[model samples]
Target chain A: MYAIDIKDIKKIYKGGVEALKGISLQVKKGDFYALLGPNGAGKSTLIGIISSLVNKTSGKISVFGYDLESQLEQAKAKIGLVPQEFNFNQFEPPLQILVNQAGYYGIKRQEALIRAEKYLKQLDLWGKRDQPSRELSGGMKRRLMIARALMHEPCLLILDEPTAGVDIEVRRTMWAFLTELNKQGVTIILTTHYLEEAEMLCRNIGIIDKGCLVENTSMKSLLARLETETFIFDVDPPTHLPSSEFFSIKQVDEVTLEIELDKNQSLNKVFAELSAQGVRVNSMRNKANRLEELFIGLVEKGSKNV
Target chain B: MFNHNYFIALKSIWRKEINRFLRIWVQTLVPPVITMSLYFVIFGNLIGARIGEMNGFDYMSFIVPGLIMMSVITNSYSNVASSFFSAKFQRNVEELLVAPVPNYVIILGYIGGGVTRGLMVGFMVTCVSLFFVDLQIFNIFVLILSVICTSILFSIGGLLNAIFAKTFDDISIIPTFVLTPLTYLGGVFYSINLLPDFWQAVSHFNPVFYMINAFRYGFLGIADVSLIWSFSVIIAFIVALYTLVAVLLSKGIGIRS
Candidate 1:
């Protein structure tokens, strides 16, 4: 069964700003889906609709085959949402907040307490369980939010910018935890500005721009669509400028030249051709394709066309 | 499947609200009692001696109920306004938005917190009033009903204020401008009978006047307005405010995207 199915979802705020327009997508069970977009690209809006945080103007959304509009409680029970903000009640201790969230799902206090303890321990928040949320550092608070969402053991977890304000160490730890959870049969949906993090964690990726979905596909296929390979050429002369017809020159400096090479065009061929032009190629490197470059290229290209 | 677990959701919000009030009991619970004691000392005893009796009772006994109502109103309004506004400030209300908790439960939970504080502070103020006079609760049922219902109505009003409040100053503005004036004019110190014809007619427009009179009638079997009129007005306000609050919450007026 599909973990989540959204069709023609639309949302317009009271100010008549349309945040999401006819957006649609699906996530298979156990799929780690990463949603990418620039600021105001409707990434969070889509997550809010599925999580029932924001009302959709028109459309349908179902979780684990339960219609969200008709069976919201069931749909919500199967999904957990970690919002972009550090929005937990700051005065309450971490443990109380977690248990209280479980209670909202109708879990008894005793059962919720047990689950809270387990998740807090799992999230490395057990020791800080008695501390008020405000006193916890930014990363700990984010982890607490993730732990709270997991108290009910939701099948689908929607994390919106979980690592946005988090430090490097905590980000890695959270990613590992979420990765392990996905391995244990939980489907994860995440929105992040860090494309590298998405590429590292998610198997499927969706790119949204200007309140619309521009692309959605497997990670491998998305990476494969980029025709350019980045090449940096270092030459002996500090003030030398090399003009080459074989590459699309991005930046030409005194000592180095950056160019984009098509996948079919070899970097070695360009280096050999430069040698024939009487330029000594000291060191050459083909920068691997990364999600950040691809995202920038796609979003910039999409926005210009719009 | 209709999830009947809204009570569960309410429980979470209620616990958080209760924890907030209780954690700062010195600030939330104690100040009102202290303030009311001073009111009884100055308005009820010292100044009451000069004013003398107007309604077949000592001046001190006449003002006790109004003072109690004042405590209830202020506590109820402040509890919800401050709590809800704090949630907004911290952006923590998003937790409820993402959960299965229906908007109504969120509304009720926050209101419940307000009512709890109002009643607690009112009860404490009542105990303090007894030390200064021979307090007598004439109509027990009406007194309890008026105080509780009025607390609920004002709590809902506070919720509306909190939703529209943009900042901490926004939270204080309503209680300062609207709530305080209406309350002081609500006949806390003097009966509407003392006011002239036009002022008495205008005093009738203050909702707090009806509530305080109804509450006062419960204590001394006397009221500025008819007892039945007072009861009906307070109940009507409760229903009207409850509906308005329900609609605003359902739309996520200020909390959602």
Candidate 2:
């Protein structure tokens, strides 16, 4: 059974703001899925509905075949949500927060204590477990939320912008922890603005725009949709630049060039043209993350269509 | 979920609530005791010296039950109101909302906390009363029942207030304007018999009057209203308030988007 199966779910706020308009999607069990969207794209709202934090206006949602309406407890038991905001009691210690969360899921105090310790240690928060959560740094508080969510040992975990304000080191650590958790057969759904993180961790991706699911496909397929790839080259200064019908080249500086190559173009032709100019070929890299380029293109296209 | 799981969830919420108030004991527990002591000093001792006897007993003995009941009612109501509202304001209440615990369990757990605080403050005030008057329990069962039922009733009131409250100021409005007036005019110090017939009839309409009288009956074996009538009013309010809280929770009125 799918970890989460949403069918045409819609959410219109009290003021008639349509946060979501008929979003339907599914994530297979044990899959690491990314739900990517721009600001106010209904990603958090959709996650809120799946976790029962927000009341949906219409349609149905099920977790592991348990209907959210009929079997709310069962469905909720299967999922853990790390919301985008810091929602834990600031005065409470991390240990108390995690243990209390486990208790809410009906775990005994003894077991809750053990699980809390395990998660605290796993999230690199063991030393700070006894400290008030508010005293922790921004990144530490985010990890505490993750530990609290995992205390119940849910089969499906949903993290919404879990590392939004975190530094690179902490974000990488979280990514490793999540990857390890997913490898252990836990279904994970992540919503993030970091397209590079999504490209690295998630196999399948769903892009939401204006409360609609604009692109839902494998990451490989989505990346393949990029019509042109931009690369930045570090080359020896040249008197002239190469010109080609398939490649768009521009001199960025004395020794740097920006080149955009179409899908059907070959780097060999561009290199031969550069060689004719007697400019030494040097190291080159993509101007931007491939997923980021595709994401921008898709969001722009979707906006124009709207 | 299993029955045991529900019990566990209840225990968790109760423990969390208990720890919360206890963690700030000086704020939660100590203030009520101090406030009650001042009342005992001012109302029971200094004022009773001049007032002489009331309801066939010394004025100090007469007002003891009412004072204790006042503490119980106020503490119970405020405990839940502040805790729940703070949770809402901080957005930490989502921890419970997103959990598998049933909504009824959530309600019960918070009520449990409110009752605990109410009774704790009540017990402390009763102990303080002992220093002024040799306390006597006319009916232990009635005393316990009245206090517990009253605490439960007001605790639910607090929950409803917290749910509807948009800001911190909103939570205090009911206690300041509504609760204080009702308790003061509920015949806590002077018996309603001292009022004219019209005012006495008005006292009958104030629910706090029934609660204080029922509790006073437990201590001094005298009441302004019948025991059956008092219980009926308390139970009816409890049922109605509980139903309102349950409906609000099910609708996710103030807690959800």
The DockQ leader among the candidates is: 2
- Can you write out model 2's per-residue Cα lDDT over B66-88, one digit (the tens) per residue? 99999999999999999999999
Q: What would the per-residue lDDT of candidate 1 be over residues A209-230, giving only the tens digit for each residue? A: 9888888999989888877778
Cα miss at A157, model 1 (Å)?
Answer: 0.9
Tell me the TM-score of each prediction against the true structure.
0.91, 0.97
How well does candidate 2 score on lDDT at residue A166? 98
Model 2: lDDT equals 0.93
Query: What DockQ does each listed candidate score?
Result: 0.59, 0.92
Q: Per-prediction interface RMSD?
A: 1.8, 0.5
**CA lDDT, every prediction?**
0.87, 0.93
| RMSD in order of candidates | 3.0, 1.5
Residue A18 of candidate 2: its Cα lDDT? 98
Lowest summed lDDT window (length 10), candidate 1 chain A:
A237-246
Per-prediction share of native contacts kept:
0.76, 0.97
lDDT of 2 by residue, A216-240 (tens): 9999998888889999989988877
Alpha carbon lDDT at B257, candidate 1: 67
